[model samples]
Target: MMKQLKTLLIAATLLFSTSQVIAQAKIAHVDTNEIMSKMPAMMEAQKQLDNLQKTYDKEFKTMVDEYQSKLEKYNREAETVTEQLNTERAKEVQDMEKRIQDYRQTAQKELNQKEEDLMKPLMDRAKAAIEKVGKAKGYQYVINSTGLLLADGPDLTTDVKKELGF
Candidate 1:
Protein backbone atom coordinates (compact mmCIF):
# COMPACT_ATOMS: atom_id res chain seq x y z
CA MET A 1 0.00 0.00 0.00
CA MET A 2 2.81 2.47 0.89
CA LYS A 3 4.71 1.70 -2.33
CA GLN A 4 1.59 2.31 -4.42
CA LEU A 5 0.92 5.58 -2.59
CA LYS A 6 4.49 6.85 -3.21
CA THR A 7 4.29 5.87 -6.86
CA LEU A 8 1.01 7.74 -7.31
CA LEU A 9 2.42 10.88 -5.59
CA ILE A 10 5.54 10.91 -7.78
CA ALA A 11 3.47 10.38 -10.96
CA ALA A 12 1.10 13.22 -9.98
CA THR A 13 3.94 15.68 -9.34
CA LEU A 14 5.69 14.84 -12.61
CA LEU A 15 2.45 15.11 -14.58
CA PHE A 16 1.59 18.55 -13.05
CA SER A 17 5.03 20.00 -13.72
CA THR A 18 5.08 18.64 -17.27
CA SER A 19 1.69 20.16 -18.00
CA GLN A 20 2.77 23.48 -16.48
CA VAL A 21 5.84 23.60 -18.67
CA ILE A 22 3.80 22.71 -21.74
CA ALA A 23 1.27 25.42 -20.93
CA GLN A 24 3.86 28.15 -20.60
CA ALA A 25 3.81 30.68 -23.47
CA LYS A 26 6.70 32.73 -24.81
CA ILE A 27 4.71 35.70 -26.03
CA ALA A 28 5.65 39.37 -25.80
CA HIS A 29 4.28 42.81 -26.69
CA VAL A 30 5.82 46.14 -27.54
CA ASP A 31 4.30 49.54 -28.30
CA THR A 32 5.97 50.78 -31.45
CA ASN A 33 4.58 54.28 -31.05
CA GLU A 34 5.77 54.51 -27.48
CA ILE A 35 9.23 53.50 -28.59
CA MET A 36 9.20 56.03 -31.44
CA SER A 37 8.29 58.93 -29.17
CA LYS A 38 11.48 58.48 -27.15
CA MET A 39 13.86 58.68 -30.09
CA PRO A 40 15.77 61.97 -30.19
CA ALA A 41 15.43 62.21 -33.95
CA MET A 42 11.68 61.77 -33.67
CA MET A 43 11.46 64.44 -30.96
CA GLU A 44 13.29 66.93 -33.18
CA ALA A 45 11.04 66.05 -36.10
CA GLN A 46 7.94 66.52 -33.98
CA LYS A 47 9.24 69.92 -32.87
CA GLN A 48 9.82 70.94 -36.45
CA LEU A 49 6.35 69.76 -37.47
CA ASP A 50 4.80 71.68 -34.56
CA ASN A 51 6.60 74.88 -35.54
CA LEU A 52 5.53 74.49 -39.13
CA GLN A 53 1.91 73.90 -38.14
CA LYS A 54 1.94 76.98 -35.89
CA THR A 55 3.43 79.11 -38.63
CA TYR A 56 0.95 77.89 -41.19
CA ASP A 57 -1.99 78.36 -38.84
CA LYS A 58 -0.93 81.93 -38.21
CA GLU A 59 -0.64 82.57 -41.90
CA PHE A 60 -4.04 81.04 -42.62
CA LYS A 61 -5.65 83.01 -39.84
CA THR A 62 -4.15 86.24 -41.12
CA MET A 63 -5.45 85.59 -44.60
CA VAL A 64 -8.93 84.70 -43.36
CA ASP A 65 -9.03 87.72 -41.04
CA GLU A 66 -7.99 90.03 -43.83
CA TYR A 67 -10.68 88.64 -46.07
CA GLN A 68 -13.30 88.84 -43.34
CA SER A 69 -12.48 92.48 -42.62
CA LYS A 70 -12.77 93.36 -46.27
CA LEU A 71 -15.98 91.40 -46.63
CA GLU A 72 -17.49 93.11 -43.55
CA LYS A 73 -16.57 96.54 -44.89
CA TYR A 74 -18.05 95.72 -48.25
CA ASN A 75 -21.30 94.47 -46.68
CA ARG A 76 -21.59 97.61 -44.56
CA GLU A 77 -21.20 99.94 -47.55
CA ALA A 78 -22.35 97.58 -50.31
CA GLU A 79 -25.84 99.07 -50.53
CA THR A 80 -24.54 102.57 -51.25
CA VAL A 81 -21.49 101.52 -53.23
CA THR A 82 -21.30 101.26 -57.03
CA GLU A 83 -21.64 97.90 -58.71
CA GLN A 84 -18.01 98.02 -59.90
CA LEU A 85 -16.51 98.11 -56.35
CA ASN A 86 -19.01 95.59 -55.08
CA THR A 87 -18.07 93.08 -57.76
CA GLU A 88 -14.31 93.64 -57.33
CA ARG A 89 -14.37 93.48 -53.53
CA ALA A 90 -16.56 90.38 -53.58
CA LYS A 91 -14.14 88.70 -55.96
CA GLU A 92 -11.18 89.63 -53.74
CA VAL A 93 -12.80 88.17 -50.62
CA GLN A 94 -13.74 84.99 -52.43
CA ASP A 95 -10.21 84.59 -53.76
CA MET A 96 -8.70 85.20 -50.33
CA GLU A 97 -11.03 82.70 -48.65
CA LYS A 98 -10.20 80.08 -51.22
CA ARG A 99 -6.48 80.69 -50.74
CA ILE A 100 -6.82 80.37 -46.96
CA GLN A 101 -8.68 77.07 -47.30
CA ASP A 102 -6.13 75.67 -49.69
CA TYR A 103 -3.26 76.74 -47.50
CA ARG A 104 -4.79 75.14 -44.41
CA GLN A 105 -5.29 71.81 -46.12
CA THR A 106 -1.83 71.87 -47.66
CA ALA A 107 -0.17 72.80 -44.41
CA GLN A 108 -1.95 70.01 -42.54
CA LYS A 109 -1.10 67.41 -45.15
CA GLU A 110 2.52 68.55 -45.23
CA LEU A 111 2.82 68.35 -41.47
CA ASN A 112 1.37 64.85 -41.45
CA GLN A 113 3.79 63.75 -44.11
CA LYS A 114 6.69 65.28 -42.23
CA GLU A 115 5.66 63.54 -39.05
CA GLU A 116 5.47 60.24 -40.91
CA ASP A 117 8.87 60.78 -42.45
CA LEU A 118 10.39 61.63 -39.10
CA MET A 119 8.89 58.54 -37.52
CA LYS A 120 10.52 56.07 -39.91
CA PRO A 121 13.90 55.88 -38.23
CA LEU A 122 12.33 55.76 -34.81
CA MET A 123 10.10 52.92 -35.91
CA ASP A 124 13.07 51.14 -37.36
CA ARG A 125 15.01 51.50 -34.17
CA ALA A 126 12.14 50.22 -32.12
CA LYS A 127 11.67 47.19 -34.33
CA ALA A 128 15.38 46.46 -34.26
CA ALA A 129 15.43 46.74 -30.52
CA ILE A 130 12.45 44.46 -30.19
CA GLU A 131 14.06 41.89 -32.42
CA LYS A 132 17.28 42.04 -30.49
CA VAL A 133 15.64 41.78 -27.10
CA GLY A 134 13.33 38.99 -28.22
CA LYS A 135 16.19 36.94 -29.52
CA ALA A 136 18.39 37.51 -26.51
CA LYS A 137 15.60 36.71 -24.07
CA GLY A 138 14.25 33.69 -25.95
CA TYR A 139 11.01 35.33 -26.89
CA GLN A 140 9.34 32.88 -29.25
CA TYR A 141 6.86 35.47 -30.42
CA VAL A 142 6.66 39.25 -30.40
CA ILE A 143 3.50 41.22 -31.19
CA ASN A 144 2.82 44.88 -31.50
CA SER A 145 0.72 45.96 -28.56
CA THR A 146 -0.97 48.47 -30.81
CA GLY A 147 -3.06 45.71 -32.32
CA LEU A 148 -3.69 43.92 -29.03
CA LEU A 149 -6.05 46.55 -27.59
CA LEU A 150 -5.28 44.86 -24.27
CA ALA A 151 -2.78 42.21 -23.27
CA ASP A 152 -1.27 40.48 -20.25
CA GLY A 153 2.26 40.98 -21.54
CA PRO A 154 2.96 43.84 -19.18
CA ASP A 155 6.18 42.21 -18.04
CA LEU A 156 7.44 42.17 -21.64
CA THR A 157 6.46 45.79 -22.01
CA THR A 158 8.23 46.83 -18.83
CA ASP A 159 11.32 44.94 -19.79
CA VAL A 160 11.37 46.37 -23.28
CA LYS A 161 10.66 49.83 -21.98
CA LYS A 162 13.59 49.60 -19.56
CA GLU A 163 15.89 48.07 -22.15
CA LEU A 164 15.05 50.82 -24.62
CA GLY A 165 15.49 53.45 -21.87
CA PHE A 166 12.21 54.90 -23.03
Candidate 2:
Protein backbone atom coordinates (compact mmCIF):
# COMPACT_ATOMS: atom_id res chain seq x y z
CA MET A 1 0.00 0.00 0.00
CA MET A 2 2.84 2.44 0.83
CA LYS A 3 4.66 1.64 -2.46
CA GLN A 4 1.51 2.28 -4.53
CA LEU A 5 0.95 5.57 -2.72
CA LYS A 6 4.56 6.63 -3.40
CA THR A 7 4.22 5.87 -7.10
CA LEU A 8 0.98 7.87 -7.32
CA LEU A 9 2.59 10.82 -5.53
CA ILE A 10 5.55 10.83 -7.96
CA ALA A 11 3.24 10.76 -10.96
CA ALA A 12 1.19 13.66 -9.58
CA THR A 13 4.33 15.67 -8.85
CA LEU A 14 5.65 15.12 -12.40
CA LEU A 15 2.39 16.24 -13.92
CA PHE A 16 2.34 19.41 -11.80
CA SER A 17 5.96 20.21 -12.65
CA THR A 18 5.30 19.76 -16.38
CA SER A 19 2.32 22.10 -16.16
CA GLN A 20 4.40 24.71 -14.38
CA VAL A 21 7.08 24.57 -17.06
CA ILE A 22 4.43 24.97 -19.76
CA ALA A 23 2.94 27.93 -17.89
CA GLN A 24 6.33 29.64 -17.69
CA ALA A 25 6.97 29.36 -21.46
CA LYS A 26 6.75 32.73 -23.23
CA ILE A 27 4.79 32.93 -26.52
CA ALA A 28 4.46 35.77 -28.99
CA HIS A 29 3.04 36.38 -32.45
CA VAL A 30 4.07 38.34 -35.51
CA ASP A 31 2.28 39.11 -38.73
CA THR A 32 4.82 38.25 -41.44
CA ASN A 33 2.61 39.63 -44.19
CA GLU A 34 2.35 42.92 -42.35
CA ILE A 35 6.08 43.05 -41.92
CA MET A 36 6.77 42.23 -45.61
CA SER A 37 4.26 44.75 -46.88
CA LYS A 38 5.75 47.55 -44.80
CA MET A 39 9.29 46.74 -45.82
CA PRO A 40 10.78 49.32 -48.18
CA ALA A 41 12.86 46.72 -49.96
CA MET A 42 9.79 44.69 -50.77
CA MET A 43 8.00 47.80 -51.98
CA GLU A 44 10.88 48.67 -54.26
CA ALA A 45 10.94 45.10 -55.54
CA GLN A 46 7.26 45.30 -56.36
CA LYS A 47 7.78 48.52 -58.27
CA GLN A 48 10.56 46.93 -60.26
CA LEU A 49 8.40 43.94 -61.06
CA ASP A 50 5.61 46.23 -62.23
CA ASN A 51 7.98 48.09 -64.48
CA LEU A 52 9.27 44.86 -65.96
CA GLN A 53 5.74 43.69 -66.60
CA LYS A 54 4.96 46.93 -68.35
CA THR A 55 7.98 46.51 -70.55
CA TYR A 56 6.86 43.02 -71.42
CA ASP A 57 3.36 44.29 -72.16
CA LYS A 58 4.73 46.91 -74.49
CA GLU A 59 6.80 44.34 -76.37
CA PHE A 60 3.88 41.93 -76.59
CA LYS A 61 1.65 44.70 -77.94
CA THR A 62 4.23 45.53 -80.58
CA MET A 63 4.44 41.91 -81.68
CA VAL A 64 0.65 41.60 -81.84
CA ASP A 65 0.33 44.80 -83.82
CA GLU A 66 2.92 43.60 -86.31
CA TYR A 67 1.14 40.28 -86.65
CA GLN A 68 -2.18 42.05 -87.29
CA SER A 69 -0.60 44.29 -89.91
CA LYS A 70 0.90 41.28 -91.70
CA LEU A 71 -2.43 39.43 -91.53
CA GLU A 72 -4.21 42.42 -93.07
CA LYS A 73 -1.62 42.68 -95.81
CA TYR A 74 -2.02 38.98 -96.61
CA ASN A 75 -5.78 39.38 -96.79
CA ARG A 76 -5.42 42.25 -99.25
CA GLU A 77 -2.96 40.31 -101.44
CA ALA A 78 -4.72 36.95 -101.26
CA GLU A 79 -6.74 37.46 -104.46
CA THR A 80 -3.70 38.59 -106.53
CA VAL A 81 -1.22 35.92 -105.33
CA THR A 82 -0.83 32.48 -107.00
CA GLU A 83 -2.14 29.39 -105.21
CA GLN A 84 1.40 28.29 -104.17
CA LEU A 85 2.26 31.80 -102.88
CA ASN A 86 -1.00 31.94 -100.93
CA THR A 87 -0.19 28.64 -99.22
CA GLU A 88 3.32 29.89 -98.31
CA ARG A 89 1.95 33.13 -96.83
CA ALA A 90 -0.52 31.16 -94.73
CA LYS A 91 2.33 29.01 -93.40
CA GLU A 92 4.37 32.10 -92.57
CA VAL A 93 1.44 33.55 -90.64
CA GLN A 94 1.03 30.30 -88.72
CA ASP A 95 4.72 30.29 -87.85
CA MET A 96 4.49 33.89 -86.65
CA GLU A 97 1.55 32.96 -84.43
CA LYS A 98 3.52 30.12 -82.89
CA ARG A 99 6.52 32.38 -82.24
CA ILE A 100 4.29 34.96 -80.56
CA GLN A 101 2.81 32.33 -78.25
CA ASP A 102 6.27 31.00 -77.36
CA TYR A 103 7.50 34.53 -76.64
CA ARG A 104 4.60 35.24 -74.29
CA GLN A 105 5.16 32.00 -72.42
CA THR A 106 8.90 32.69 -72.08
CA ALA A 107 8.26 36.23 -70.92
CA GLN A 108 5.84 35.00 -68.25
CA LYS A 109 8.36 32.50 -66.93
CA GLU A 110 11.11 35.13 -66.83
CA LEU A 111 8.90 37.55 -64.93
CA ASN A 112 7.99 34.90 -62.38
CA GLN A 113 11.66 34.06 -61.90
CA LYS A 114 12.60 37.70 -61.47
CA GLU A 115 9.94 38.21 -58.82
CA GLU A 116 11.14 35.15 -56.92
CA ASP A 117 14.76 36.25 -57.09
CA LEU A 118 13.96 39.75 -55.87
CA MET A 119 11.75 38.60 -52.99
CA LYS A 120 14.04 35.87 -51.65
CA PRO A 121 16.55 38.21 -50.04
CA LEU A 122 13.84 40.39 -48.55
CA MET A 123 12.11 37.32 -47.11
CA ASP A 124 15.38 36.09 -45.67
CA ARG A 125 15.95 39.47 -44.07
CA ALA A 126 12.52 39.41 -42.47
CA LYS A 127 13.09 35.89 -41.16
CA ALA A 128 16.44 36.89 -39.67
CA ALA A 129 14.87 39.88 -37.93
CA ILE A 130 12.09 37.72 -36.55
CA GLU A 131 14.58 35.21 -35.19
CA LYS A 132 16.68 37.95 -33.62
CA VAL A 133 13.71 39.55 -31.91
CA GLY A 134 12.36 36.21 -30.70
CA LYS A 135 15.69 35.28 -29.15
CA ALA A 136 16.30 38.69 -27.61
CA LYS A 137 12.82 38.80 -26.12
CA GLY A 138 13.16 35.28 -24.72
CA TYR A 139 10.18 33.94 -26.61
CA GLN A 140 9.87 30.18 -26.45
CA TYR A 141 7.55 30.16 -29.41
CA VAL A 142 6.84 32.87 -31.96
CA ILE A 143 3.70 32.26 -34.00
CA ASN A 144 2.70 33.95 -37.19
CA SER A 145 -0.54 35.77 -36.44
CA THR A 146 -1.57 36.21 -40.04
CA GLY A 147 -3.31 32.82 -40.29
CA LEU A 148 -4.45 32.53 -36.66
CA LEU A 149 -8.14 32.85 -35.89
CA LEU A 150 -7.40 33.84 -32.31
CA ALA A 151 -4.12 35.53 -31.39
CA ASP A 152 -3.89 37.15 -27.97
CA GLY A 153 -0.16 37.02 -27.38
CA PRO A 154 2.17 40.01 -27.59
CA ASP A 155 2.70 41.13 -31.18
CA LEU A 156 6.32 41.13 -32.34
CA THR A 157 5.76 42.71 -35.74
CA THR A 158 6.72 46.16 -34.57
CA ASP A 159 9.79 44.79 -32.86
CA VAL A 160 10.86 42.94 -36.01
CA LYS A 161 10.26 46.07 -38.05
CA LYS A 162 12.39 48.08 -35.68
CA GLU A 163 15.08 45.42 -35.73
CA LEU A 164 15.17 45.59 -39.53
CA GLY A 165 15.47 49.38 -39.27
CA PHE A 166 12.23 49.82 -41.20
Candidate 3:
Protein backbone atom coordinates (compact mmCIF):
# COMPACT_ATOMS: atom_id res chain seq x y z
CA MET A 1 0.00 0.00 0.00
CA MET A 2 2.87 2.43 0.80
CA LYS A 3 4.57 1.66 -2.51
CA GLN A 4 1.37 2.35 -4.44
CA LEU A 5 0.89 5.69 -2.65
CA LYS A 6 4.45 6.76 -3.43
CA THR A 7 3.97 5.84 -7.11
CA LEU A 8 0.79 7.96 -7.34
CA LEU A 9 2.56 10.97 -5.77
CA ILE A 10 5.39 10.73 -8.30
CA ALA A 11 2.92 10.52 -11.21
CA ALA A 12 1.06 13.64 -10.02
CA THR A 13 4.36 15.58 -9.66
CA LEU A 14 5.36 14.74 -13.22
CA LEU A 15 2.03 15.95 -14.60
CA PHE A 16 2.35 19.27 -12.74
CA SER A 17 5.87 19.77 -14.04
CA THR A 18 4.73 19.19 -17.63
CA SER A 19 1.92 21.71 -17.28
CA GLN A 20 4.30 24.37 -15.94
CA VAL A 21 6.63 23.82 -18.88
CA ILE A 22 3.77 24.36 -21.34
CA ALA A 23 2.58 27.62 -19.69
CA GLN A 24 2.32 30.87 -21.71
CA ALA A 25 5.64 32.51 -20.98
CA LYS A 26 7.07 34.72 -23.68
CA ILE A 27 10.85 34.49 -23.98
CA ALA A 28 13.23 36.21 -26.36
CA HIS A 29 16.91 36.94 -26.97
CA VAL A 30 18.63 40.21 -27.77
CA ASP A 31 22.10 40.36 -29.29
CA THR A 32 23.82 43.29 -27.57
CA ASN A 33 26.59 43.30 -30.14
CA GLU A 34 24.03 43.87 -32.90
CA ILE A 35 22.51 46.84 -31.11
CA MET A 36 25.96 48.35 -30.52
CA SER A 37 26.78 47.92 -34.19
CA LYS A 38 23.56 49.55 -35.33
CA MET A 39 23.74 52.53 -33.00
CA PRO A 40 24.95 55.62 -34.89
CA ALA A 41 26.09 57.30 -31.70
CA MET A 42 28.29 54.38 -30.85
CA MET A 43 29.83 54.42 -34.30
CA GLU A 44 30.61 58.11 -34.06
CA ALA A 45 32.20 57.64 -30.67
CA GLN A 46 34.37 54.86 -32.10
CA LYS A 47 35.52 57.08 -34.94
CA GLN A 48 36.54 59.76 -32.50
CA LEU A 49 38.42 57.19 -30.47
CA ASP A 50 40.21 55.97 -33.59
CA ASN A 51 41.39 59.45 -34.48
CA LEU A 52 42.55 60.09 -30.93
CA GLN A 53 44.42 56.78 -30.98
CA LYS A 54 46.19 57.75 -34.17
CA THR A 55 47.26 61.07 -32.68
CA TYR A 56 48.58 59.33 -29.61
CA ASP A 57 50.50 56.88 -31.75
CA LYS A 58 52.08 59.69 -33.71
CA GLU A 59 53.09 61.51 -30.55
CA PHE A 60 54.74 58.42 -29.13
CA LYS A 61 56.59 57.75 -32.36
CA THR A 62 57.87 61.32 -32.52
CA MET A 63 59.15 61.08 -28.95
CA VAL A 64 60.97 57.80 -29.64
CA ASP A 65 62.45 59.16 -32.86
CA GLU A 66 63.76 62.24 -31.13
CA TYR A 67 65.36 60.14 -28.44
CA GLN A 68 66.95 57.79 -30.96
CA SER A 69 68.44 60.71 -32.87
CA LYS A 70 69.91 62.16 -29.72
CA LEU A 71 71.34 58.78 -28.71
CA GLU A 72 72.91 58.30 -32.14
CA LYS A 73 74.45 61.74 -32.09
CA TYR A 74 75.83 61.20 -28.59
CA ASN A 75 77.39 57.87 -29.61
CA ARG A 76 79.15 59.57 -32.50
CA GLU A 77 80.47 62.32 -30.24
CA ALA A 78 81.52 59.81 -27.56
CA GLU A 79 83.55 57.88 -30.13
CA THR A 80 85.72 61.01 -30.53
CA VAL A 81 85.96 61.74 -26.72
CA THR A 82 87.19 60.21 -23.41
CA GLU A 83 85.58 57.33 -21.46
CA GLN A 84 84.31 59.79 -18.80
CA LEU A 85 82.09 61.59 -21.32
CA ASN A 86 80.71 58.27 -22.58
CA THR A 87 79.81 57.20 -19.00
CA GLU A 88 77.99 60.46 -18.25
CA ARG A 89 76.13 60.36 -21.56
CA ALA A 90 75.16 56.73 -21.04
CA LYS A 91 73.56 57.63 -17.68
CA GLU A 92 71.72 60.50 -19.34
CA VAL A 93 70.39 58.25 -22.09
CA GLN A 94 69.19 55.66 -19.55
CA ASP A 95 67.34 58.34 -17.55
CA MET A 96 65.74 59.66 -20.73
CA GLU A 97 64.66 56.15 -21.71
CA LYS A 98 63.08 55.59 -18.29
CA ARG A 99 61.18 58.84 -18.49
CA ILE A 100 59.89 57.98 -21.97
CA GLN A 101 58.66 54.60 -20.73
CA ASP A 102 56.84 56.26 -17.85
CA TYR A 103 55.31 58.80 -20.23
CA ARG A 104 54.13 56.06 -22.55
CA GLN A 105 52.52 54.15 -19.71
CA THR A 106 50.78 57.25 -18.38
CA ALA A 107 49.54 58.16 -21.85
CA GLN A 108 48.08 54.66 -22.34
CA LYS A 109 46.26 54.86 -19.02
CA GLU A 110 44.80 58.23 -19.97
CA LEU A 111 43.67 56.92 -23.33
CA ASN A 112 41.84 54.05 -21.66
CA GLN A 113 40.21 56.49 -19.28
CA LYS A 114 39.19 58.69 -22.16
CA GLU A 115 37.52 55.79 -23.92
CA GLU A 116 35.53 54.95 -20.80
CA ASP A 117 34.51 58.57 -20.38
CA LEU A 118 33.31 58.77 -23.96
CA MET A 119 31.47 55.48 -23.87
CA LYS A 120 29.76 55.57 -20.47
CA PRO A 121 26.74 57.54 -21.66
CA LEU A 122 26.28 55.36 -24.73
CA MET A 123 26.41 52.24 -22.63
CA ASP A 124 23.84 53.63 -20.25
CA ARG A 125 21.55 54.44 -23.15
CA ALA A 126 21.80 50.93 -24.48
CA LYS A 127 20.97 49.46 -21.08
CA ALA A 128 17.96 51.70 -20.66
CA ALA A 129 16.82 50.79 -24.14
CA ILE A 130 16.96 47.12 -23.25
CA GLU A 131 14.69 47.56 -20.25
CA LYS A 132 12.32 49.78 -22.22
CA VAL A 133 12.12 47.29 -25.04
CA GLY A 134 11.59 44.35 -22.74
CA LYS A 135 8.79 45.96 -20.80
CA ALA A 136 6.90 47.15 -23.86
CA LYS A 137 7.03 43.80 -25.62
CA GLY A 138 5.53 41.70 -22.77
CA TYR A 139 8.59 39.52 -22.59
CA GLN A 140 8.76 37.49 -19.41
CA TYR A 141 12.51 37.23 -19.87
CA VAL A 142 14.82 38.64 -22.48
CA ILE A 143 18.02 36.71 -22.85
CA ASN A 144 21.34 37.74 -24.36
CA SER A 145 24.25 35.93 -26.03
CA THR A 146 26.12 36.18 -22.76
CA GLY A 147 23.25 34.50 -20.97
CA LEU A 148 23.15 31.57 -23.37
CA LEU A 149 26.88 30.94 -23.07
CA LEU A 150 26.78 31.32 -19.32
CA ALA A 151 23.92 28.83 -18.99
CA ASP A 152 25.10 26.52 -21.78
CA GLY A 153 21.42 26.32 -22.70
CA PRO A 154 19.14 26.85 -25.66
CA ASP A 155 19.30 30.21 -27.41
CA LEU A 156 16.38 32.50 -28.13
CA THR A 157 18.70 35.24 -29.39
CA THR A 158 17.49 35.12 -33.00
CA ASP A 159 13.81 35.35 -32.04
CA VAL A 160 14.47 38.32 -29.76
CA LYS A 161 16.51 40.09 -32.45
CA LYS A 162 13.78 39.51 -35.01
CA GLU A 163 11.10 40.84 -32.71
CA LEU A 164 13.03 43.80 -31.31
CA GLY A 165 15.40 44.72 -34.19
CA PHE A 166 18.07 44.95 -31.52
Q: What is the C-alpha lDDT of each candidate?
A: 0.80, 0.95, 0.76
| Candidate 3 segments whose C-alpha is farther than 4 A from its true place | 1-25, 146-166
Worst 10 residues of 1 by lDDT: 153-162
Cα lDDT of model 1 by residue, 1-166, tens digit: 9999999999999999988875685877777767766666777887888898889888888887888888889999999989998999889888887888888889889888887887777777677778888878887788888888677864355566666676
What's the TM for model 3? Answer: 0.72
Higher lDDT: candidate 1 or 3? 1
Query: What does the lDDT read for residue 80 in candidate 1?
Result: 99
For candidate 2, write residues 9-90 as lDDT tens digits: 9999999999999889998999999999999999999999999999999999999999999999999999999999999999
Top candidate, metric TM-score: 2
Model 1 lDDT at residue 85: 89
lDDT of model 3, residue 43:
80
lDDT of 1: 0.80
Per residue, candidate 3 scores C-alpha lDDT tens digits across 1-166 of 9999999999999999987975666665677777666677788989988898898889888888988998999978977988998898899889889978987898889889988998898778776667666767676766676546554433444443444444
What is the lDDT, from 0 to 100, of the residue 137 in candidate 3? Answer: 69
Q: What TM-score goes with each of the models? A: 0.73, 0.83, 0.72
